[model samples]
Structure formats: structure tokens, C-alpha cells
Target: MTQVNRPQPPVRIQSSRVAESIAADLRQRILRGTYPEGPLPKQDDLILEYGVSGPSLREALRILEAEGLITVRRGKVGGAYIHPPNWSSAAYALGLAMQGQSVRVHDLAMAIRELEPRCAESCAEREDRLETVVPALEKNIEASEDALGDGAHFTEVSRTFHDVFVDLAANQTLRLVVRSLVAVWTIQEQAWADAMEGEGRYPDIEQQKAVLKAHRAITRLVARGDRNKVGKIATEHLAATQPRVLQFCGDRTIDASSATAMRGFRGLK
Candidate 1:
């Protein structure tokens, strides 16, 4: 006697799975500049293009929105807006993860102390330092000098110096990683500056001058292409300056729900 095979049932894909597949395709398109002009094509258009139901397409948009890839607005003028991910998004995610793990502010400071100097060293190693790196840093130093007496303003300018330093580094991966850490640290430091100013304990002008001196020294080292000295100087400068903020933070963990960080995210392009 011979046995016969039964007919097989059609495989039905879940809406959620369909949504994920739709999301992946749209996500790549958004990231690759497919919709560079504006918010994604109208939802109706996307639904048509993907040949999926409205619910499935909407679910796909939801996934991208949650990942910071796009923003969906609801109104007569509403549509899903594309927001390509950048360093700030990376920083916000990093901040959330650190907050989830209860990572301390001092721990973040320590990580920056070790990592950022390498960025400075890399800046010194850049072949186009004169055209690309030095001018930006020197201009930032001038802003720092002008901001010397205003503690809060000075802190902001000084932080920009480090931001520019990291941005100028030749290593793209290190630049992004360090810059994310710096962005997170900037929120804390700026908050500390505000609090200290309120309490009349913000670093005095003399202390601000000292910071300027260190920044100038580091700039000179980079201009001279002295990678060895620039890294060492950067390390020393961070060591001296971080304590002013860290002392206020104590054992407090970074706040992922920080309104400042969120506000920064909102302004990202």
C-alpha cells in the first residue's frame, strides 16, 4: 500500500511581522536619502507602495518613530516626518541606557577623561590640522577668553572647544562615540553651572582663567602637531575641570529623563 501526502495550508504572515518588514524597507529608504525632501510620502502613498493595509503601514511607522528614525504628526497637516539618526540620537539612546543601568555621573566623567584625550591626540595627528582643526579650535578659544567672567557662558564656550576638538579627529568612529559621551556630559555640566551660579559658588573668574590657560595650551600643542603633549595636556585639563561638576553630582546617576537632553533632541534635524 502506498501513502499519499496531504495538501498544505498557506502560510499567513502576522500584521506585526508585515509591519516590521515594511518598516525595514522604509527605514533603509529614509536613511539612504530616498525621501530627502520632507516627511515620508503621504501615508496613503506608502500603503499603496508597500501593498499593505493601513494598520500594517501605520505599525511600521510606529516602529521607525520609536527608533528615532521618523516623527509622526497627527492633524490635517500631519504626516510621518523623516529624521535621519545622528550623534544626538546616539547620545540620547546612550544616556537612556546608562540611566537604566544606574550609571553614575562620576563613572561617565571617568570614561570621558580616558576617551576624549585620544580624540585630542587624533586631532593633533590630522594632516589638515592647520586648515581644518587649528582654526576652529583657536576661534573657540577666543570665545572662551571672551566668556571668562561669566561662569555659565564660559562653561558653554569651553564645552564647545572640546566638542570641536572631538569633531576634528580623523577617526570617525571615535569621534561619534566620544562626541555622544560629551553631549551627555554637557547636559550635566551645564546643569551644574546653573546650580552653582544660583548658589554663588560657580567657579570664580580666576578659575575660569585657569581653564582658559589649559585650553590655550592644548590648542598650541595641537597646532604644533605634538600628539604626545596634546593628549597629556587634554587628560590633565579634564582631570582638573571635571571635579567641579562631579563634586556636585556626587553618586547621582545620569538622568535619562533630563528635560535639557530631550529639548536638544527636539531641535535635531
Candidate 2:
């Protein structure tokens, strides 16, 4: 939202230091696709490659696992496997930062309100150069329309709409920073949507229709070189929607670890 642990050095446990260095090297290898066929080079092969003992290599793999760059499995069928780098990991990291600084969901929403309109302005300018951009937003709105009454499914797709808009805005900094906020907020909103299910907290069709109309209007305005209109409309749309959703949330702070736990993990196979 805003400006976003250690162990003691045990006496002469050189393997711990070894593990960190090994994790760094293997992280690069996985990222660079050195192990393309399989998610990992063989455990025995890694031991040989790194010239380390089995325990040391295992320790390195554990470090990588905690960093979310790899998954380590035990048993005969198990081995360390590379996990792809992704926004969720960055989002989790951002959540951790926000947690340390005592950031609230309200702060995050405010940041989005401030920054996303800038993204809208940027999106308007970029749409002129990239003809496909507006169509992409249009597709998202169509999908949202189709999901009008399905709270769970709509929760996921609606995020894609916001994420795609931020992405197409043609600003790398906003894409990374804003979308990290987006990624975490979506995780929270998924849980929020479920909590709101029976209580009828989700927008009714009329409200949904109004939102869809606004998005469609925003899309049209952005297409017509109306950067100011894009920013004004987007900000107002978000401002209007935010309080309604937060009204249901109360004072719950977003905990990234819990969100990931609740959603469960789906690592690359």
C-alpha cells in the first residue's frame, strides 16, 4: 500500500552458508531453464554438480523451497522441482512488507484509488498505439457480464479485468507495484466473496448492470482519446465499489500466508 527473520551463525556450520550459496546458484539455473525436461536436475546429479554432500544439497533445496523458487519432495519418487517465478510470490512478499509496516486494506485501496487512475490515463495513451488493448478490456467486461450472478467465479475473472488493465497501461513500474497490490487483494477478495455469499453482499443484477455499464463506458471513453475521462470514470467507479465491499469486510487485515493456505497450493507439474 505504502513504502513497502534471522538465525544465529552457529559455530562453524559451514554447510548453512553452503546452502545459501547453493540455493542462489540453483535458483538461477531453474530460472534460466537449465533443467528443461524435468523440473529439477536429478538429486544425485545436483550433489555431483555442486560437489556437496547429500545433506548439504538437501539443505540448499530447503532454502529454495522457502523462497518459493523450488519444491522438494522426499521418497523414491520425490526430488527437488523448480517452481516458476510468478506474481503471487511477489505479491506475498509485498504483503509481508505491508504487514511489517502495519498497512491496512484501506491503505491499499486508497493506493489503488490514487495509482490506478494514473494507470487509466496511461492505458488511454497506450491503447492508441496498441490496437488490441481496448478489445482486451472489452473481453473482460463481457466475461464479467457472463459471470453476473456467480460470485465465486466472478471474483476471479474480475481480478483479471483489473490486472489486464494495469498491465496494458504500458508502465512497467505500475504493472509490478500496482499488480502486486492487486494480486494480494484478489486473494483477500476471494475469501471475502465467499463470506458474503449467503448474506447477499454481492451486487445484485441491477448493481452489476450499473458496473458493467460503467466499465463499457470507460472502455469507450479510453478508445476515444479521452484520457481525463478514463481517469475520472475509473476512479469514481473504484471509489463507489470499494466502500460497499469493505463494509462487509469489517476490520480484517489481509494475511497473505493465510490466504495462500486457504486457497491451497497448485504448483507446476
* Candidate that would win on lDDT: 1
List candidate 2 stretches off by more than 4 Å: 1-12, 32-34, 127-130, 151-155, 259-261, 264-269
lDDT of 1 by residue, 1-269 (tens): 89898877543457889999999998888888887847889999988888889999999999998997988999998999887878888888998999999999999999999999999999898888989888998899888888888868788788899999888888899989999999888888888998998898998899998988898899899989999999999999999999888889948999767687677545432
lDDT of each: 0.87, 0.75
Task: Report the C-alpha lDDT of model 2 over 122-218, residue by residue, as the tens digit.
Answer: 8888735347668888889989989988876776666577777777778787777887787666666666777677667766678767778888888
lDDT of 1: 0.87
Instruction: Evaluate model 2: give its lDDT.
Output: 0.75
Off by over 4 Å in 1: 1-13, 264-269
Residue 218 local lDDT, model 2: 80
TM-score of each model, in listed order? 0.92, 0.83
TM-score computed on alpha carbons, candidate 1: 0.92
